[model samples]
Target: MEKYSTNAINADAPVMLATERLLLRQWQRRDLGPFADMNADPEVMRHFPAPLDTQQSNDLAARLCQLIARDGWGFWAVETRSHAEFIGFVGLRETKPDMPFGSCIEIGWRLAQAHWGKGYATEAARRALSFGFEVLALEEIVSFTALPNLRSQAVMQKLGMHRAPDDFDHPAVPQGHALRRHCLYRLARGAWQEQQP
Candidate 1:
């Protein structure tokens, strides 16, 4: 049976997930500059709507922190355990403003160009799935990205998320926007556990 329970959910949850080469933790004030730089890079933001400015990056981080403060799990700042360099973030987020699943969460990730092809996103995303299914006991977790963002779609496939037929224009984005046409993928708790190595 799918293990979907909200009983373990709580705000004020601790952050800090460490892998062999990476550390996923809460966003720090000092990390904002580099984070902003990443978000502002056209190459990095190519799949996004547009490059974000410093204030926008700060606001986004603040909002993510607040979400974690309220819901117990949110995007995590990803860094190298060896050098402690902030490369990107990965975690779970609620689908907002005309969400497909209605009161459901999704797993997502973003990485700097310098960190691309390094498998950091896939590695961190795997851990995030562990937290969602094994720890949080979430029933299902979904991920969505622009139809053209095949890199992200590849990562989702690597993490074992199956594509859904329904394509929705993201309400938060303007209609006819390139980023608005999104393809969704989903993985149920039982399927996730079954696919584990």
Candidate 2:
């Protein structure tokens, strides 16, 4: 999936956004270790099919980096302002056309196990949503996770995304896999603006 050329505000520059406590910036080489460690943690990977090995994690990171480099925005690496510690990643990405919701940009996050419950996901997501609407002028953004991933659902709710009525089987997950079923949440630009101060 690719970002639209007509919508991106930073099409030629490296992407970076800041929150009160976090910095959402381009992924760095130093981020791979922490990123892989986070991916390897079973507790953190519990919602997915399985934990990613080091090579898988590094490969994923490289793709994310390339997307940001190409489109000027993707799932940016999130770090702290005070500590500059790489907690994880949070940002927007384009979903494949075949995804349950069809082609659209979606918000996503993955944080280190140690960083759970710190409001980092919500804070960084809020900024990402703002960029999606204000900067990219997107019409909508959606998020989804396995049916059992209520933690991620909570973050979606925090961002004012309403649960879609139907559940769908994620094609990417193998048939009969426990994580195959997913719930979707969406927020439209008009609704998002109404929710803002």
Scored by TM-score, the top model is 2
Candidate 2 lDDT at 84 equals 97
Question: How many residue pairs of model 2 clash at the backbone?
Answer: 0
Task: Estimate the overall C-alpha local distance difference test score of candidate 2.
Answer: 0.93
TM-score of the candidate numbered 2? 0.96
Per-model C-alpha RMSD: 2.3, 1.8
Compared with the true structure, what per-residue lDDT tens digits does model 2 show for residues 42-79? 99999999999999999999999999988889999999
* TM-score for each candidate, following the candidate numbering: 0.92, 0.96
**lDDT score, residue 90, model 1?**
94
Give each model's whole-structure lDDT. Answer: 0.85, 0.93
